[model samples]
Target chain A: MELLGIANYLVLFLTIAGVYALLTLGLNVQWGYTGILNIGVAAFFAVGAYTSALLTAPATAQPPGPGLPVAVGMLAAMPVAGILALGIGLITLNLRSDYLAIASIGIAEIVRLFLKNEEWLTNGVRGMAGIPRPFAGVDIAGWSAGGALYLALTIAVIGVVFAALQILYRAPWGRALRAIRDREVAAEAMGKNVLWFRLQSFVLGSAVMGLAGAVHVHYAGFIGPEAIDPLFATFIVWVMLIAGGSGSNLGAIVGALAIWAVWSVTELLGQIPEEPITGFGALRVFLIGLLLQVILLLRPQGIVPEPRE
Target chain B: MVELAQLLIYGVVLGSIIALGAIGVSLTFGVLRFANFAHGDYMTVGAYLVLPFYAGLQLPVAAAVTLAIAGTALMAVLIDRLLFERMRNAGPLVLLVSSFGVGLMLRSAVQMAWGPRTLVYESGIQLPLLFGPLRIKPDHITIIIGAVLLVLAVHLLLTRTRMGKAMRAMSDSPELARVSGINTAQVILFTWVAGAALAATAGFFLALDTNLRADLGWHFLLPVFAAAILGGIGRPYGAIAGGYVIGIAQEFSTLVISATYKPAVAFAIMVAILILRPTGILRGN
Candidate 1:
């Protein structure tokens, strides 16, 4: 590919990676800091994406969108995602972690099914299109300039989220979360109100995921059921969070970028000459799953191990 | 009345598949103490493994099923040795995540080998048998009978045999069982064998009842888990009852609601059960 072509792809890749970093950070807060096993990342994500799409997309005859301002739609995403998480967490968070995992995945599936079947709300499988970009009509120097601007905007969002999370992780409340995660019994005995703290973390983290979804949908200018594969979205974020050390905000960002690189490289490899394998897609997924196994076996703490107090 | 009876029969047949799969899930929970997320994928693998023998080699259905069961059992043992056994000391969350990874790998392997398209054992559909107001298929009878016999066999194995007693003992108290000279490792192996074989049988019958697709087991994952949980985790008998309830609820749901929401029925039952009675109907440990 030519230099300009490569730059465009690079900008797109970085933008997507930044969005994923937001998600990884959100997951890091829930699973890493709060010890909540939320397997419904995609559900929250879809909630945000659809919420924003429905609010911001131009009024259409079939889907019947509100066509509100993009900024308002993005602003609406966090509460929408947070409320859903609150409802789910209230019911299932008090149970064993296993039950939480099952319940979360079930919720994710329910969300997906609703999105697929509720034609009146989500346009069914046809999905919402022509979602306006952040600055669609802005005049730029070149064609690639818009891509670069979006990439910068995504990075800025990531930086703010990362900084906020970093400060939170180092704060007393964050330490309490860590304490709850490491030893819930001890934390509860210390009058920590463990469930309350966990609920906060779960809601906050899910809202961040919703924000990431808003960023993603805006960048792509579309939202659909096909946009999110429940398993791939959830597990890949997991791989990123675990592979990059959990409990560390920087690790979440690092993991997101590194895993995205590996993911894209594998996809590129599948496109190589000499008659690529017919099942290359499945093979790539298999390799990713194997990578998770290898990491768990060899480095359970991940590349950037959580810092000891 | 006939329609209700027909739905009940269909529910029972569907419940049998869930029951077979849930038995393994509950057994694993009892022994391993972690939800094996790959159990559903194992079901798919078992069904896919049978394709080579039943369709590719044109073998008899019985021989093919036997081969598939053995192959799946071997696969379970291999998985235990390589992935799960090594993580015996790890926390339940770690094991659960690892199981997710294993499930992904298995699913992808099935897709890679079989392609994304659906495959069926036989092309043409058989006419349903009518008995008065009731209509059923030979496949339904086979599924119902197979499930009952398997459940009965498991009951016998647990209650009548020495190994079964050892398993029960271990599940109750592994440390005590160890002190009592029960071979923990061997019993664990036996658990996997039994669980995998049952799952394979369920997968086979499910494929026979429906069509074989990569997502066949994936789709069943939630329902099976719901059954296992509803019957109470780690309680095999509870899983059987849970399976029937879920099956009947799902089939009957189509009468009032759209069929597309069938999977959600299991989720609803599971959530309600967890909220109302976390221990399930059987009140498992």
Candidate 2:
């Protein structure tokens, strides 16, 4: 019985790690390949998660959403996030990478404001709940079986995304992005439409981030502003990518799994009561933050450095 | 008429705090070529640092503020020597991300130490000093004067001091400055000192204006960045104008929009500036 409980815990961990893997992949497309500094990961994550949850929310929910199929909710999330990216990208993609980072942070805050204040649309601070899991009606007999099935769905999506990104980054389009990132003037001289290419990459990456958010909400079976904290949604992904090898697809998955393990472990340790320290809530964040510093100093390319072409 | 006047007064006071913080942000970015995302936390640390001197030890307000600012400057210098100095050539993205990590560390440390409770410097509020239709706090007046004096001092230092010239030279062209026999390390140290000192003071003033919380500086970070960008990147003078513009705009916006959405006003203005006048109002570098 204890072993069975452990197995269930492992499934839950893998599912959460898989969701983070998606975010890392999305960031890999932007920071790793295209060299765009998008720090607004939370914004897109919130959009996708809330979009799906709101649409699929039960009829009994307050301020009622569409009561649509979970499939519809998941399908619409990507485009909504993509459209947001398109609007911000048109203006900010021209900025120097640092300014772009600041602007993206602003965008995230604005989205948070919208989610917190717009009751009619987002149900305000109460947030949209009652989101159905991927296969809510399946008679799995227990939470463990249902969770395992969803874990399979998550892994399957990760497989498809990993394969698609592997192909995308190897094509001529990928080479041009690298060239632009390495030497923008040179890429422009080579007749590559630099801004246009950047816009496409930004939109594509954000859409994937949206998909990650949807996957996460379905797994958790809830959606709210608190779930998409910037500390988790944005900064953690950056650390995972850097720790795994930014430009490598396999690295994103590995980094997600590794960092999520560290985070979970720290969380467990933080739960232990201590007399002098009342701030156990901050233990994991403080540790993870320190980890980033150590990574930058020692092994910046991550545990698995980007593979040489 | 009175309401508009009151709002304008509030605008000027809030603008003073932002300008102080913006100068630090603008100067650091100009010299270091990276936005120190930890800057807001710099202010937060400053505010917290003042507590031991002022409340715990019962020191005078000015002395407490001075010691706190000095401590924040030292911390910034140590941070630079320990971390940023090593990554001088790591490109902007690495530095920016590292700085963000540093910010998280600072914020989390604060949470650990202080236990995430709202703190105040003084227990009771002082009645506002009225100027016809306007009402202002003594702390607000102090903020405005302090900012003006500090801005003046920075202006003189930049225009008249040799160290200031070297810093500007590096900002304009690193190679040229290197060839000219400037002490690059010394200039970098000075930049951190100046920026962090100002950030600490701005934060202290902000705490005096509003209540103090662990997330105080983090919440206001966007406006400070907006002020820096609005004036022009790498331009301290531009940051001052940018600060006032954003501060006033936010205050006046409350007349039309919900108060809950004040932060978005800064963002909207920042976006507009990025689209229309990317160089900033003062044509910054």
Candidate 3:
């Protein structure tokens, strides 16, 4: 609770927000750029977290588990998450936009439920603990120093992702996606495989979410299915994208930071004493809900509004 | 045979609840022309609102039930007028997102009013009615009866009545209904009243079977959506049938899969239905 303590908290918050920024950017690429409402984004996130955690968290001399190095764990997470997304997209790609949204939500929920119940793989509700950090033996100065280090690493990853997305956005493939999004039939007439484009967007989005999750797991040093709850993925990320301006990468990053700031402050306020502040916890949540409602009603386009044609 | 009978009874009872839930979703989707993710949360609020009536006032069972249903209906209509109606003309995405906001607000409000714990409306209600190897409870019977009465009333209201016809016209084509001199706003209000009444009633009956929790309707929203889709979106009768199909499927999935993984069954069925035929089983459209 000291100033330094608050700084430490801020650093931790920024790191997590940066991770979400990555996740939201992945969503923006799918939803904003491609108009594909991928509601099951969290499934890949779970895959990544579970993958990294299960692999890196030293083998417990037990059966039915695959424990590997953290880097390798991160590597496995991307393909595993991507493949799942591809499978889901294959079945759902032909669906209308709204139905696609509903299906993805269902898929995310199913993945979460599986992770929560599949005790042999996920350790069930007890959750996996003791996930190791890279360079665990190194005297990382202090928790604040660790926070700074994590933030720097996240920033690096974000930079790389942004660069890659920049290239895609400028490429012919990206233009085709935009065409498909803006006018599916016209894009179809032009011989663009709309379904295939959608599937690719979905798989790529899921991969990005997985990478974010991999970073998040190592940072938080734990993994549980609850971490990828559909509500968190849909509601929170939706809010972030809207608050930022959906179609813009910068908007996603800014929105993630701003919303995460509000969330953090409200969460902290919820814990504050309530002599003159009765029901602060509930009030904080209420305010967040109110904030979202007000935003949607007054400015449906959002803060950094996505440019309209 | 007895086990099958029992399953059927349970399925019907569950179906009744599903019917009630789907009414809210279908009506909102049909009339409002947008997916209201918050619709389930309203059911959650309706159940929570029952706590004061049933538990606090300690009124007679029927009286408390009536009060709860009325209060929830009023709340739903007010929400429609104040919130949903404003966004009625917005694009689907805007409406969807706004409803999410509304749902979050309602959920937080409930969590604020009543903490994140489950409660029951204290009752001296007895055990299941034994019929051979099968057993069913008074709550189940009440749910079936109540849901049937409500649905029949809605059916009558929608078809036999002038207002009902207007609603149907509106659903078929809102602008045409308005041009035809139907009071579009009034029909919308009526739809909310009817849909919310069904929802609150379902919430109450669901609370009877389980306990009242803030997340009750949300937990059921997926299966309820699956039911609505299975029934072909906006058809009430289809929804009723679909709900039963969903309920039975959900319960039976547990026999094949682990009980813990039973919830995933709803999504699997939903995906299969969508992939196989997006129009759904009933073919209302």
Candidate 4:
């Protein structure tokens, strides 16, 4: 590949990695810090993506979206996703963690089904296209220039989110969250509102995920129901969070990049094989599954273990 | 009245499959104290295992079912020994995540072995048998009978056999059961075998009724989990009742909502039940 080609691919990879980094950080807060097993990460992602797409996309006759500013759509995405997480957490948080997992997955499926079936809203299965790219209307040299600009924009967002999360992680609220996670009954005895704290973490984390989704849809210039595969978008985030060492924002970012690299490498290998495509596709997923098992068995605490107080 | 009866029968048939699947989940939760996310995949494995005997070897239906049951039971035991047994001391969350990994692997393996194309046990559909205003099929009868016999057999084993007593004792209180000199390892093995066998039976019947696909079990995963939770997480009898409730609710939901939303009904019922009575109808430990 030429130098420019390499740089282009590098920018693309970095841009995607930054988006995932946002998601991982969100997950780190929910699962790592607050001990809320949210298995429906894609639901929040979809909520954000669709919210932005409908708001920012050009006025269309079919979906009937209000062709508002992209910034407005992006701004709306966070609270929309947060409200959804709040409602779901309110209903299912009373159950055990495992039950919460099951319920969250159910909600995700329902969200996906709604996206698939509600043509008037999500444009059916075809998905909405022509989602306006950020700064696309600005005077740019070409698509490559726009790509680089988007990459920089994504990184800036990631940095902002990372810094904000780091500050929160060191705050008294974060400590109380950890307290509840480690010893809920004890925390309650200590006069901590355990459920309320957990709910706050859940809402905040999911809002971050929604922000990432809005960024993702704008970057891709399209949004679809198929775009958010839970295995890739949700479980893979879990794998990254666990592998990179949960409870650390920096660790979540590192894990996202590292796991995504491995995932891309596997995809490249699948493409190289001349045999049936499905075989390699299935093999890739199977290997990931095996990797998860091996990781859990060998290092449940992860490589960059959560720091001790 | 006939339409209601028909829906009820259809609901019962679906409930039977879910009940059989949920029993294994409940049994495993009772003995191991963790929700096995891969339980539904075991159903898929069992159904796929039968293809070799029935489709490849062209064996009789009965023979194929027997082989599938044995194979799936053995696979369950092997999985327990290889993956779950080692994690006996791990936290429930860790176990739950591992089960998810196992489920993903099982699903991927099924897709790899048998392409994504859907397959059926028999090519032609059987005409429904009419009795007064009601209509049923031979396969439906078989499913109902098979489910009843299996449930009865499980009841007998749990109540009449020594192993059954050991299992119940262990589920009730594993620490006490161990202190009382019951063979914990033996009971665990028995639990896996029984649970897997029931899962296999459910898969076989599901395949007999509907088309077989790689995602057959994955699609059923939510409903089965809903049943288990509704029935009380670790109570076998509770799962049965939960399964019927879910199935009937799902089938009857079409009257008011789109049929595509049938699965959501299970989720609604489960959440409602959990909120109203966390202990479930059976009050699981």
DockQ of each: 0.85, 0.83, 0.59, 0.76
Candidate 4 segments whose C-alpha is farther than 4 A from its true place:
A60-64, A137-143, A275-278
Which of the two, 2 or 4, has more lDDT?
A: 2
- Candidate 1 lDDT over B111-202, as tens digits, reads 99989899999899799998998999999999999999999999999899999899888888889999999999999999999999999999
| Clashing residue pairs found in predicted model 4 | none
Which stretches in model 2 have alpha-carbon errors above 4 Å?
A137-144, A272-277
- Each candidate's lDDT (Cα)? 0.90, 0.88, 0.78, 0.87
Fnat: each model in turn: 0.80, 0.77, 0.54, 0.69
DockQ (model 2, Cα):
0.83
lDDT of 1: 0.90
Model 3 reaches what TM-score against the true structure? 0.93
Report the lDDT tens digits of candidate 4 across residue range A183-284: 889999999988789889999999999998999989998888997676557878888888888888888999889888898888877767687476777788
Docking class of 1: high
State how far residue B276 of model 2 sits from its true place (Å). Answer: 1.0
The sequence of per-residue lDDT tens digits that candidate 1 reaches over residues A130-165 is 887876656565563777888888898888888998
- Deviation in Å, model 2, residue B125 alpha carbon: 2.0
Which one is best on lDDT? 1
Q: Model 3: per-residue lDDT, tens digit, A149-254?
A: 6778789889988888868877898889889888889999999999999889888888888888898888877777665555755677778887887777778888
Cα error, candidate 1, residue A37 (Å): 1.4
For residue B200, give model 3's deviation from the true position in Å.
0.7
